[model samples]
Target: MFEFSLRQVALCGQQPWEEPGELAEPPSDLAAVIGTNGDQFRDSFTRLCLYLARTYDDAPQTRTDDTVVIGTEYGNTEALTRLQLGALADGKMLSAKHFPNATSSSASAFVNIGIGATGRNLTLNAGLLTPVIAIWQALYALAADRSSTSKVLVGDVYSAEALLDAKREANGLRCRSGLTHATFVKGREFRADFDFTADHEAVVTLGAQIGSDKSIDRNGAFVTADFLDVIQKLDVGEQSVLTCRGPLARRGALTVTRQNFDTVGNGGLGE
Candidate 1:
């Protein structure tokens, strides 16, 4: 019922570090810039928030009163890996570390670290629809008069091995490890449609067409058809529609970016 548009989007990936490539040194004060790392998910998650905070800091379009909603499907994996290897020594860990080279400071606070105290919220296991869901959540809140202004943050992180394993195990398919983010703002219009086939397969449309122009831009190769099919498998008897106007949702529709692994879905891509 609420309409919205994406304001900004920032995404990160572990594959760049996994494979050989030139890299930039992050500020030594990364701990200060972004909150200290808790684990892979938290660190990568923090980086996402940090990038948005820094990039949009002085933008006239963004405000201190904006709201935030974070969506992720990798929360379980993040929590699981953190518990399994949070304190393990170098060789004992599953892969290369992506956080700061120092210990975390318990005294540190995330109170306005990036997006500020704009009533940020989080949603886990939000599926591929996370980014949009986050935007919708913020807009819905505003429409209900729950908040004066809203800004949304949505991101996801994955482990190389575990990501591929889950994909294969789920449906004998393969996937890669990557993280994504999307920030949204209030918009002027919205639309949606849904129906069921005679055979009862649910079909739905979020917008009249995919917004390839207004989406977060990225480079990579992925299976578009597979993703479309995956989305339709929402449930046995449910269908929904969603549509939006504005620069964010009307341009490039949300896409799968950062294809850091192979299509085999097997463990051949990375360690």
Candidate 2:
């Protein structure tokens, strides 16, 4: 048996300097994450990941055998919007090299290369379930390696400036770096509905409860007892405290505040 007590986790992101209620930064990691839209997407993501790994996860290193998973609904929208803006400005096709950095997988790839991490790497864009699923998947990998240490980095990056004009048509999760909101709701579902104005970014660090017995899929849609691997059918708005038991085990609970049952398995309390 893996005799270890996994506790404490930290999250860092580009949130407003004033509204950080439960978050803290000694020197200003948040400041370093903010920049000219796409220019800082990978920077913010990596810095936040490094900070969380250092502050919360027990195993800390620039490069490790630990696996890394990333999630974001709209990543590098700034790069896309910028390419559009540049084309409009010059009336020409945007350079191909410019948009590759805009791909949703960019951040995770950059982090993997920067840290020289040679373990499993994953990225997702399944809306709200993205973060939850990434965390669950990371837990699965870590649980399987009880003797070794591991951590998960679940975050989001959205260019607030780019979304400002699109907010009216922009359906969900307006303008934010996406670190904090991802952290707050990744594990625990937020019951209240809220709206973001603009020029905001957030980052969230996700950690597993010490002894949860539930096994959650990558998208956090279906959950099961880790030991039995039996899928537990859930209903909309049905809340439950959760636990996990497996190779990567934990004990904790997050209430299922809501579930968006899309045919694509896009299910969760907050999606």
lDDT score, candidate 2: 0.40
Deviation in Å, model 1, residue 197 alpha carbon: 11
Candidate 2: regions farther than 4 A off = 1-8, 13-62, 87-100, 143-149, 161-271
Candidate 2 positional error at 118, Å: 1.3
| Global lDDT scores for all candidate models | 0.37, 0.40
**Model 2 RMSD vs true structure:** 14.4
Top of the candidates by lDDT: 2
| lDDT (Cα) of model 1 | 0.37
lDDT of 2 by residue, 1-271 (tens): 1111223333333344423122233235444533234443343444454444443433335556756666554544555566567678998875666544656566666555655567777776544344335555555565566313334455444345524543544223223333421111122211222111221224321222213442222212223112111112334564344332111122223233334333322212221
